[model samples]
Target: MSWQAIAKKDLQDSIRSRTLWATIGIFLALILLLSWLFTDGSGEGTFIAAAGFTFLIGVLFFIPMAGLLLSVKSIVRERNTGTINLLLSLPHTRGEMIVGKFVGRSVVMVVTVLAGFLPALLYIFVQVDEAGFTQLLTFLFALSVFGVMWVGIGIGLSALVNSETQATITGVVMFAVLILWPLIFEQAGIELPSFAQRFWLFVIFADLFFLPGRIADGDFTFPSVVEFDEVLLEELNDVAISVGPHLQMWFVVVLVAFWIILPIGIGYYRFSTTDL
Candidate 1:
């Protein structure tokens, strides 16, 4: 069998997972409920507003949780349970297994992101006056990339570890670094150089939440924290502007490429050399 066959099998397995379905169900329900609770009834630019709310909740909570849940144990579980031997008995190499698992799990995450954002799309399409389809599509594409990045981290962590426990601990640490560090930095008022702050924000997918309305409206701005105190938001804007070309949108490509490639590459390296 080839890596394609492994990817197909993994996809089928993920589709059958009750936990995956449950995560999707909860994400969809919460996004809709939050949209209802948070959406202003003024009906002016409601689509972007509602989508902003959904994206915030997803970025802060659901997307990371689901990504970790679906991928963090992928390779380690197979190794621990002796399925790795059976898989190797096939014609595929170990590299194919790692690639297949990452691709398969990444597909699962994309589907989860799509399902989670369907409610936001409902609001977007309903507000056709200001709801630029291009904007929504752009933000959704960015959101998918963010979610897939987490899947890569989880899969990489799984492959690097030898046990389920190690995977779990590493997953928690990864989540904290990716999801909580920015919040800590913002809340504690920690000082960093402007360029470093912008780079770190993008690293944690903060820019995706920070610019949802701009992204949904197709008017790009330097992304900053807009959900918090007005004064802090202004400060962030100033810093964002002062950083100039150091933190361009193209830098997002560089960071995403680094994150997606480094973890998987490291994990593949470890997996390739380790005795299975």
Candidate 2:
């Protein structure tokens, strides 16, 4: 079969599946609820920052879950249904098959993000005067990169594993590792003897997860104690700046490129070698 046919079939299967829509729905609901609770009617600059940051966290969790769910069965399910053999017998190369699957599923993820997040963003813009268009745009760009990486990782894991359960578990474990690794390292409290050492450490950790360490760095400014009122709607300005250590932008870009390419290369290698 042609690559176009393969892509069409995969896209149809995804649309017929309700799990994809369900996951996106849940994410949208969470974002709306959080916005209602945290956002004040005021149009302060900090309000935009808070909403954008909260939305970023929500998308981080949502994108990985969606990627894992959509991709965990891309190949294993075909094998289970005895369709893999027929597909492998086609004139298309293994690389074509793998690439077609990735493209099809990645398209689904992109649509999901646009559908679920775009309207929510519009609502925020209309309802909250504090919403900054620039910040929102930046958050969306970051989220797109994050989503693509997770989808690539999921496709790679699915291609490598034989069983659907194994693929699902592997995807979940990898997601957890990527998401939590930075926090784990930070909590471990490695003694940084010098500024150079600290900078390199940030770069190393950030590269592993494909996230800029600057985003994760905690507030460097003093005035450690934050009042309780600041935590509630009564005071939104009490949030402290958690910024100090940061990875260079170039380092993040390189890491993102590695995340997308390396897994896909391995998937192609495995697909090429596997017996039809």
**TM values, all candidates:** 0.81, 0.74
lDDT of 1 at 13: 88
Tens digit of per-residue lDDT, candidate 1, span 38-142: 554455654566677656777777888888888999999999999888888989988899889988999999999899877656764574357766666766777
Report the lDDT of model 1 for residue 74: 98
What does candidate 2's lDDT look like per residue over 7-85, in tens digits?
7888998898889889778878877776655555454445355555556566557777887777767877787777878
* Pairs that collide, model 2: 218-242, 218-243, 219-241, 219-242, 219-243
Point out the worst 10-residue segment of candidate 2 by lDDT.
219-228
Clashes of each: 0, 5
The segments of candidate 1 whose C-alpha lies over 4 angstroms from its true place after superposition are 127-129, 183-190, 198-246
Give each prediction's root-mean-square deviation over alpha carbons.
4.5, 8.4
Query: Top lDDT: which candidate number?
Result: 1
Global lDDT scores for all candidate models? 0.75, 0.64
